[model samples]
Target chain A: QKEVEQDPGPLSVPEGAIVSLNCTYSNSAFQYFMWYRQYSRKGPELLMYTYSSGNKEDGRFTAQVDKSSKYISLFIRDSQPSDSATYLCAMRGNSGTYKYIFGTGTRLKVLA
Target chain B: EPEVTQTPSHQVTQMGQEVILRCVPISNHLYFYWYRQILGQKVEFLVSFYNNEISEKSEIFDDQFSVERPDGSNFTLKIRSTKLEDSAMYFCASREVGTGANEQYFGPGTRLTVT
Candidate 1:
């Protein structure tokens, strides 16, 4: 099985709607979870970061990790057209190295 | 806020030719990394550098690939002999410290096309 799996969603939602993106992983050692936003032809930018399980909120975005289920999620509240982009979920083990494993990413569109 | 910067936003080269992608990480960052994303594929880690040496590298990082911190500010990834499969977007990332908890900042990336 792939170490990390994410729906390659071209998920479209209306402006002001709530958007939830998720990823599942097989590695139980992964301790740090991150969400990145990437526009077409642009680099991935850090959107939200969380360590271990629980919920982390930053502005309109919230990141949740369920280590027991090996699942992670990023939720965008009050989505806007400016929020349209591919969301990539990345994770790394607790080792003191920066090696990261990434999901295929989900494409999201927030319609105006 | 400091950000990583990559140069030659796009590059096209002939197969078997050597190509080097350059990046300037955040000045205070102590860890550097290289990752690549092939067309329609997930981003994959290539290698990580800290304390002037490789901390870890994925299997995809073969002997043909090499990374260097040639100067105080610049980090580079060199593909000795490019293959068509080498065509992908290469990203440079850096973190303030070599810790699993620190957030990494990524550069825009360099799109390499090996024909």
Candidate 2:
């Protein structure tokens, strides 16, 4: 199985709607999970990061990790057209190595 | 706010030619990384550097790929012999130690086209 898996969603939502992006992983050793936003042809911009399990909130974005399930999620509240971009889920182990495994990003389009 | 920066945003080269992609990471960052994304694919880790040495590298980072911190401010990735399959967007990222170490700041990226 792929180490990390994410739905390659071209998920469209209306402005002011809630958007949820998720990823699943098979590596139980992964301890740090991150969410990045990438515009077309641009690099991945760090949005949210969380260590271990539980929830972390920053402004309109929230990140949740369920270690037992090996699932991670990024929730965007009051989504805007500015949030239209690809969302990438990345994670690394606590083994002192900085190598990150990434999932196929989900494309999001927020209509105005 | 300081950010990572890369030069030659777009490069086109013939197969078998060598090409070096350059990046200037955030000045205070201690860790540097190189990653590549093929069109419509996930970003794949190439290598990570710290203290002027490679700390870790993925399997995809083979004999043809090399990374260097040639100077205090500049880090570079060199593909010794480019192949058509090498065409992709390469991103440079850096992370600082201590607080917020998990956050990696990425550069805009260099699009390499091998023909």
Candidate 3:
């Protein structure tokens, strides 16, 4: 299985809708979990990052990690048109090598 | 609000030619990395450099690929002989520390087109 798996969602939602993006990791050793937002033809911008097995909130975004189930999620509250982009989930092991394993990003479009 | 910067926003190179992509990471950051994302694919790690050496690299970072810290400010990736498959978006990232607590900042990226 791939180290990280994310649904390649071309999900469309109306403005102000709640958006939930998820990823499943096969490696139990992964400790650093991150969410990145990428625009078309642009680089992935780091959104939220967490190393624990709980939820972390930063403004309108929340990142949750469940080590036991190896599941991670990013929640966007009150989404807007500007939130239209590809959401990528990335992680790395604690081995200190610092190479990130990334999932195939989910493309999201928030319409007016 | 210092961020990583890469040179030549877009590059078009012929196959079998050598192309060097350049990046200047955040001045205070300690770890540097090179990653490539093929069109419609996941971003794949190419190599990581710390303490002026390659800390780790992936299988895709083969003999055709090499990375160097030419100076205190610049970290570069050189493709010895470009192949058609080398066309992609190359990103440079840097982290303040090895621990997972810190976030790795990324550059805008250089779009490479190997024709």
Question: Which is the leading candidate under DockQ?
Answer: 1
DockQ of prediction 2: 0.85
Q: DockQ (Cα-based) per candidate?
A: 0.89, 0.85, 0.87
Select the stronger candidate by DockQ from 1 and 2: 1
**TM-score per model over all chains:** 0.97, 0.98, 0.98
Candidate 3 residue pairs in clash (backbone atoms < 3 Å): none
Model 1, A1-112: lDDT tens digits are 9999999989999999999999999999998999999998788999988999999999999999999999999999999999999999999888758578899999999999
Interface RMSD of each: 0.8, 0.8, 0.9
Tens digits of per-residue lDDT for model 2 on B18-84?
A: 9999999999998999999999999999999998899998898999999999889999999999999
For model 2, the stretches where C-alpha displacement exceeds 4 angstroms are none
Write one digit per residue (lDDT tens) for candidate 3, span A1-112: 9889999989999999999999999999898899999999988899988986999999999999999999999999999999999999999887766789999999999999
Error of 1 at B20 (Å): 0.8
DockQ score for model 1? 0.89
lDDT of 1 by residue, B1-115 (tens): 7889999999999999999999999998889999999988888999999989999898999999999999999999999999999999999999876344478889999999999
DockQ of 3: 0.87
